[model samples]
Target: MKIVRSKEFLGARAWDAQLIAAMQDATVRLHWTDQPYPWHVNDGQEVFAVLDGEVAMHYREHGRELVAHLGAGDIFYAAEGDAHSAHPLGQARILVIERAGSV
Candidate 1:
């Protein structure tokens, strides 16, 4: 994983791409944007907290769509092994945390 040497210049609503490698511990990511994110899945469970704007968590299954929106200080969990999608609901900032499980 890329070591975050510092938290400098981490500003408002924007989309940034980060790749974490060989991380077996919990990690946190901050997102500030109002753009649609592509469908994807991660290797672990994730928690998202909307600290500023709004974010909608989307899931597609069996030809149906499910949606949930989170506002300021709202929190949600992303299931492991599920194809999930997310996008900012408004101009917003979010905190994402991923936990590491036993090997």
Candidate 2:
């Protein structure tokens, strides 16, 4: 068993991630980012969880842009074909689960 600490990700660069597990074509990771990510569509479904701090998630749905605020413990899910981006309110640590090799 491995003991992973999510807080360890705080203050790291945007998009920095720790691989927690991988099964088949799916992966679970812990990420740290204070910067905003570019909008992109997932090759597969995505599950995003806020572990520390706050985040403002931007997503495109039906050609409309939407924003969702995520605090610690909040969760966001994206189906395949969902285009989205995440902008941290400040520095934040998050957990992301998605298909391996997805950009």
Candidate 3:
């Protein structure tokens, strides 16, 4: 059994993550970041959940750019080949689940 105090988690660099678990072909990770992640499409589906703070989720749809404001407890789902990026308002902790070894 494992216990993680999400609020107590921190990383040395932006987007640094703590591996929470490896479930079959997917990986659950706790990430701490104050910076924006570059826009990219995942090889598989991705689930992004905000654990604390706020984030502005930027995504491209039909070649148009859009943004979704997200706060704590909000969840964002990205299907395969969906291009998106995340920009934290200040500092935020997020839980992400995606295929193992995905970028």
Candidate 4:
């Protein structure tokens, strides 16, 4: 058994992640970041959940740009082929579940 304290987790660099589990073709990760992630489309679906702090989720739909503010306990789902990026308001911890090897 493994126990993780989300509030106590930190990384050496921004966006560094702790691997929580690898289930078949998917992976569950805990990420800590104070910087924004670059925009990209994943090859499969993605589930992003905020565990601490806040984030500004920027996404594109219908060729338009949009953003959604996410706080603790909030979740953001990204379907395959959806272009998106994450910008933390300051520092944040997020739980991400996605297909293995996807980017």
Q: Which lDDT tens digits does candidate 3 get at residues 1-103?
A: 9999998988999999999999999999999999999989999999999999999999999989999999999999999999999999999999999999887
Assess candidate 1 and give its lDDT: 0.66
Kindly list the per-residue Cα lDDT of model 1 for residues 67-87, writing each as its tens digit.
887788789877676677777
**Tens-digit lDDT string for candidate 4 (1-103):** 8999999999999999999999999999999999999999999999999999999999999999999999999999999999999999999999999999997
Alpha-carbon runs more than 4 Å astray in model 3: none
lDDT winner: 4
Better of 1 and 4 by lDDT: 4
Task: Report how far off residue 55 is in candidate 3 (Å).
Answer: 0.5
lDDT, residue 7, model 2: 85
Q: By TM-score, who's the top model here?
A: 4
Candidate 4: residue 58 lDDT (0-100): 100
Cα deviation of 88, candidate 1, in Å: 1.2
What C-alpha lDDT values do all the predictions have? Answer: 0.66, 0.91, 0.97, 0.98
Ranking by TM-score: 4, 3, 2, 1
Candidate 4 lDDT (Cα, 0 to 1): 0.98
User: In model 4, where is the ten-residue run with the lowest total lDDT?
Assistant: 1-10
Against the hidden reference, what TM-scores do the models get?
0.68, 0.93, 0.98, 0.98
Q: Residue 67 lDDT in model 4?
A: 97
